[model samples]
Target: MPNKIDFGNGSIDFNIETILIKKNNPEVKKLAQFYIQLFQNPNIQIQEVDKLEFTQKNSIILGINERRDAPDRYKIQVTPYGIMVEASQVKGLFHALQSLTQLVKLNPENKAGSIRIPTVIIEDEPRFSYRGMHLDVARHFFSVDVIKQYIDLLALYKFNNFHWHLTDDQGWRIEIKKYPELTNVGATRSNTLIGHYTDRPVKYDNKEVSGYYTQEQIKEVVEYAKDRFINIIPEIEMPGHASAALAAYPYLGCTWGPYKVANTWGVFEDVLCTKDTTLNFMKDVLNEVVDLFPGKYIHIGGDECPKARWKTCINCQRNKRRFNLADEDQLQSYFIKEIEKHLYRKGKKLIGWDEILEGGLAPNATVMSWRGETGGVEAASQNHDVIMTPGSHCYFDHYQSKNPREALAIGGYTPISKVYAYEPIPANLDPKFSKFILGAQANLWTEYIEDEKKLFYMAFPRAIALSEVLWSRKEDKNYAGFLERLQFHLPWLKTQKINLTNAYAELDYTLSKSGDDMVLHFVKAPIKGKVLVEFKHNANNFTQEYPKGDSLILSNSLDLKAWYQLQDNSLCKPIHIIYNKHKAAGASIQFIEKPSPKYFSNENSIINGIAAPTNKYSGPEWLGMEGKNFEAIIDLSKSDTIDQIKFQLYNFPAAWIYPAKEIIVEASTDNLNYEVVGSWKLSPFTQERYIEPIVDLKKNKSYRYLKIKVINHGKIAEGSPGAGHTAWLFLGEITVD
Candidate 1:
């Protein structure tokens, strides 16, 4: 202990005097060789040992115990005499070595001297059978080395499933030898989107981009992952998200001629035609995919297949009729079933996004629920295997912090805490079908993540949270303990050069209105670091630090700044929360007609004061009434001479959102009845415009109750996004002045 080195600028190195090995066993021999060369990592080398010598104090002994039943479980005992690792499987030895590697890094001893390790027995095993992490290389390609490093990280965390998202609208990331152009043309794009995918009118960057993994490289990666006890699930998108494939082979698409790999991201109208020739091409491509991946599941993407092309394609309609399919959704089921049958012949199972349940699920298909829990719930109800990867909790591409100035991300928020709280098995599910729930995974959609550093920043910590969620028992999971361990784990990650988000430094705050209406409610996390509050008292520059757990009173305006103060004194970044004391900031409001199920519980825009969600359904702050009237009652607590009330709505022709047909404002003294005060009949004026519709009353009007009713543009017609569904009336803030 006296020769111990400081925490920084030093490491502890140990020399294993001997390693035991069984000459006849292959697994033990491979593990012994790996351990012998592992010293190269710490700049130490030891000669090979032929004998299992436990008499020496510095000797390390490893033995295979096939007596255990568990698959990857292992036991390690470190004593003053020596260290012994016993495993029932080859993977267990690899995992035991990984634990040793972590111990070496986390130890406080110096690299210059030897240290004593206390005698203890440690046993570890994964809770969930399938612990997964996903990477969408199609959006932004990573070379084979990066892929192997990714697998190493997965193995380091004890995750077994590496979901390789290899295909999308933007590009294809895999090679199919039968179809040369699938990699040649399908893997390339004309130009990348200059900014975020949500950028209005969509801009473009100067250079064209392209990348693909050759079949040989992919096989090597597969072998590498196999060595680390990781299974690679190859994703080959089909029927939808196939613009890249259609770009390479136009004859396979519903529409003929001039198709190119999409430079932008989104569900496209172009899809693979449901034709015999197309099926043949799919078979050829899938043959290579099935051969390349030794894993049991082949992910055939059955997500976001816009039926617009299928509805119009003559062959699609004929196939629907011929197969007795009810609609285009059922037509998609036909396509998936065909592919499933092909994979079945190759002795592989078919897995797809929850949308595969649209028409009908294929026999022996697994569902990956990404949109929300309903798909997973439905899949489990029908007795299908389900992997819960809901976007609300598992999507890392979303902005982790509330600050708009953070890295440009796809709209929405999925912070780390939310990811940690995810429960793969829904409680409401009948206990009988629980076995079908095959755990959960975090999805790193790279639509906005263009670089490896950004990708790592987005994936780490969140992925770590996901790792614990899937690996640790529910009773053993503790957020506080996780944060404490993470603090120490970060230094080790920095040593490995893993670019972490340090997302804990991002302040997660919430705002509410105080009952008196004079003071504003502000809440923050008491996490790893300090939560510093700086505010401008009334109207001035932000230079004062407000103490924690105190009310912030609002005057003309309240400009609040909250930062996650780290131990280094240097703040990770500061986030601004400007509350300009709007008239309805602290008003009690009731939703007469609440928003639709998906957007109802979340949107707190009406009373939060901020004019949220300038775009429809773009942010969580908008109260959207899809195909229904948005009727609300704003209780002002007392009668006031209110002159006018304002409303906000966004119109994007593609998303089935439009201006309200009419807005009516009424006033009343009692709760029962109301009299009309003002009304406005309007039409959608522009595409993607945030229209502010205000209703002004007489100056003398003093009322306790204000009834605001906005009619929806019901039932979007055939051409718009989500067509035939109810057109939404997205409302952000309802301010009274």
Candidate 2:
């Protein structure tokens, strides 16, 4: 937002017959022509004059004054007569033009050849110097044209950095002159995963997909971004996520002679070996990468590198002994430091994922914290620069809404509201180290996103909110006001043929208990759209109409479906909820063991009278624990007859979430002592993904307190996504009948 925006009474009937520039500068004239196109009126023309005196009454003037407070700061003034934009540099002038584009809107009463401009004086500059957005092209390749369009979208929102993820396990997506095999052999995949990675009977498309950018194409993109003031940071994975590169040259791997580019996603056990030959091979690749990109920093993906292969490889073990390293972790650290030295020698700096902090961090490497903020805080505390892109807030691949009708996305939920609320600086960090926080970025990982339309659906609206979070003052944030401005841009986006998602118009709901009664609450969307809900209960169906911000009482168990009727009268995809009005519907739960922060929802989801779908364990309705047991005591408030206890556990080994090893149900009257009513022990080899363990008592019993204990399977077996790590245990709704 602008530091100051003073709106005056009345509006300007801006008949833009001509755009007057201060001098005949090519760059300035080019910008003038671009803004003219934004007007969408052929009558608008550009004129280069020796002096921009603002002598004309109905002309737009673009001028430069080298006295602004900041390099990117600019001022805009609009009166009933004409409009003037002044800035210190080309970047600032570009920003001024963008603001002017937003200020002018179509004339409602008169449909053509003219526009209405808001009369205001505005002064603005960005809050952070490094406002960035990232895209991963290795998983699913996007063409050079689409890449340019992506940069254009970033420029429209005033972002200054574009992180281009060029290489990963799925495929290497950049051309290296000396290493022809890197493209010829490493750039293609055998097949892609059919659906969610955890889907059992693992399916594949069995078709080839491949792409890579040539040197000329990369130069073209670099120049395009340079014109828009966006610096491109190209990522080349190293030490880990190097399966694609290893497949091209098997000599780079610890177990040489045979390798193939990964056909699926996730961490691969094979990585770049620490031997001198492999190190030199990586340096050779970097030599070409550095020549192609003029940016100061290069990203070496130092994440998700497994030590299993390194532990057994002869060369890696020899290198560890030669360096007197304590373990494989330090060997990985050694590998990163070697690469950092190489980049520094090439006149570039190093940026790596949070795992670079593993054994020890490199002396001058900047950290891109993706797992969470702890790594960022630690790096900042050590006086190293950090870019915070935690998965909770910055992963665009996460589901924007709980609407099941939405496109398939990588699991996790990060809505626009969550992205807008992100604060780059950790509140608990020391003030002295706060300067190391370089800003933040949001990553679009593309594992689930397959094409351009799906990509735009996940990026926009959320990206818009992120722009404000990165550029505007913290005090200037008003989501309501932002939404109002976004409405004006919707038409422009459509004109550009961008397939942006209207998540802002989607209805959202919450489940909770109020005074012993379970209630389903509806929150109003930012846009003024009507919401309709349909209920199916007792073999009868009925539809109820309600405006936004209403609640319904769950007096009976039913299948409830709700959707939004947008302004265009198009209904959004409906969200379904299965309500079970059981004896423990609104019960209070006291947890003996709490869930991990990554999967913690509200404390009441277990007894909120709702159940998540069997296959969808990532929703808030399920609580997940990492290598921990589930022990909770539910207070029913009053004694009720109970004969059966039912609950479900999610078992998806591909994702490392395991079913229960045992389940025990007990009852108590005074909350002090408990007697076991039913118990069951299960094997870890069950094929059922959604395990619904049942415990039935021989006779009905009345008790105010019911205790449930679920034991989790320990570490994951030898060949899973998170092998050798503690398994995640997810529990869904619990019902007492």
Candidate 3:
């Protein structure tokens, strides 16, 4: 990720027999020890020398120079004598060591008991100062040791900020000295959710899930991160996502009396009431939190706070009138501003989710835009600092690939390529507002990630690609070169036993329509490999080995799989595709109302000859709209006999997406004077998969135009995910036969 680099003709051998510290700085020596431990050679030893000895070819010289330019800029020169790393600051020196670790391949065995180091001159610095990675431990608590391992990985990639989400409705993972019950009651849930939240007849493990970090443990982690030059930004959710706090002390709730820690995930109606007692309680908690974390900012989660309770509470209504607030949103804003004032008085800034921008943004608040980039762009335009963590590209909890072997993710497709393609600054934003755009961070929400190994599997390789996005210049980015370098690091990660996903090696394909045939184009991999594709078309099976970018034409419905076979005879995981060549396949279609942008897919997904997997409701195969009727017209290009019309609908009420209440199918000869052919009322049911309802026509009829109208389920029923809110309607591929 260096800005400038020049490769030399040959490589030099380094034994690492000793290291000479230019100023004898204890911090530098300590960091050298940490970097040396990464080597595979067990017999390696580090001895500090007063002066650089040119005779010792295996020695590394670390020098700190006076700051005359970028404090994080570092230079590494590998020549015949030895490797010398020079920097204006310790941060730059650490970056150099990280690069050196890659250069030596973790000190692989070489000739004459020395390691072959690439001979090169490199200068590197980060593109953004606020490079960060967020971990949500509240959903699933990880031990302190595992947290340190995560920090180590972040440091290896030169991340500066670690956003530690320590509190949520699921559990509170940080200890407050003044509030003993916060850990005793709020840290434990009665039981954990057994499976996907959308599962029908919800089940639980019936085993207690609990954990919390004592103040001493928090201090330990802070110091550990400090040693690696990583800032730990502790998040203490407030106003919203405060169910755990309310459960700990009932006085914080408007209803008062009793509340239990949420055993399940999603937004809750019970939030901290806007009262003096709750404000003081939150200020006290932040006092303890700010004492533990030395970072300048504290993330006060202000996202997804339902106002159901506030709408009925007398005290909340009184406060609303007293403050002359327009609605519940303004009340929430006032609540956040009060907290921000307290933090500012304590010499700290405030960070909140983009929801804080609802009524009025805090005067001095940094926004973490998770829903999308619109909020970030708005905040930046208002001259407020914004960190772009849009869920589309940065939510690591989403499925990284569509492969069946992948673990259960929250849902959504965010391949590593999409993450790499992300530009922290949106192109549409004005250049003047770019300064307010600090950087971007990836969030690893742990609702689905249960253990440390799964955590690493979800982060790695993708995290590596993110490091380049935040460090290297945008114009200088070369994914092909990054892959070549990543190939070297993957082996080193294996030697260290890091669990990384192999989706990076899988072949990526694009689907399109061409004259009644679906074309699947497989892009070539940068590494040495051959694409192995197998598919069935027209009742004929075909298998072939394609050495490069190749296109396959599918003329009929079938299951297809494609994978990469490396030169070492190892196979990368294959991606499975299901094709459904119905009468409407490759036909022209027009939408009466477009789907919501929040859950949009390809425009032609409905007629692309592919059926959406029932397991996932979001991705390239489904289009979703909120409380809107689905009315579409499909032209078959020529009159054809049609006896049946079928389509799939998602019914995950837990996500507020319900199946259509009724479907009406009509046919026309000249795109006019359509006559109803069939109508069926549906019984929507909550489940993990979609429901395919077929409408059998009264009799066989030939028509060139088909008009399908679907009635959306109204508002979500009480006690549902979005109770009383407009329900979502997700439609899958359409089939006319």
Off by over 4 Å in 2: 24-27, 33-46, 105-113, 321-324, 514-516, 537-540, 547-549, 566-570, 588-603, 625-640, 654-656, 668-676, 683-685, 700-705, 711-729
Q: Per-prediction TM-score, please?
A: 0.89, 0.91, 0.90
Candidate 3, residue 482: the lDDT equals 82
Instruction: Give per-residue CA lDDT, model 2, range 290-360, as digits (tens).
Output: 99899999999899999988898999999999999999999999999999999998999999999999999
Alpha carbon deviation, residue 596, candidate 1 (Å): 4.3
Candidate lDDT values, in order:
0.78, 0.86, 0.85
RMSD for each model, in Å, please?
Answer: 4.5, 3.1, 3.4
Report residue 465 deviation for candidate 3 (angstroms).
Answer: 1.4
- Model 2: pairs clashing at backbone N, Cα or C within 3 Å: none
- Rank list by TM-score: 2, 3, 1
lDDT-superior candidate, 1 or 2: 2
The lDDT, on a scale of 0 to 1, for candidate 3 is 0.85
Candidate 1 per-residue lDDT, tens place, 1-737, comes to 00111232232234555666655777676666666565453332333455555766566677777856786777777765667787788888877877766666565462423544445567776667888999999989988888887888888777889999999989988888888898899999989887866558789997777999999999999998987889999999888889889888899988885798888887788888998889888889899898899999999888988888878888888898899999888898999999999999999999999999998999889999998888888999998999889998988888887666678887678877788878888878889988888889888889888988888888887888888888777877677777776776677677778886665656654555567354544444445456677766755655545565645565556566777767756576676766646666777888878687766544345667666656335555677787899888888888888888888877765667777888999988887788999988775455546888889888897898888899998887786777878888887778788
Candidate 1 TM-score to native: 0.89
Clashing residue pair totals per candidate (backbone < 3 A): 1, 0, 1
lDDT of 3 by residue, 603-665 (tens): 678878788778778677888888998898998889989888888898877678888989999
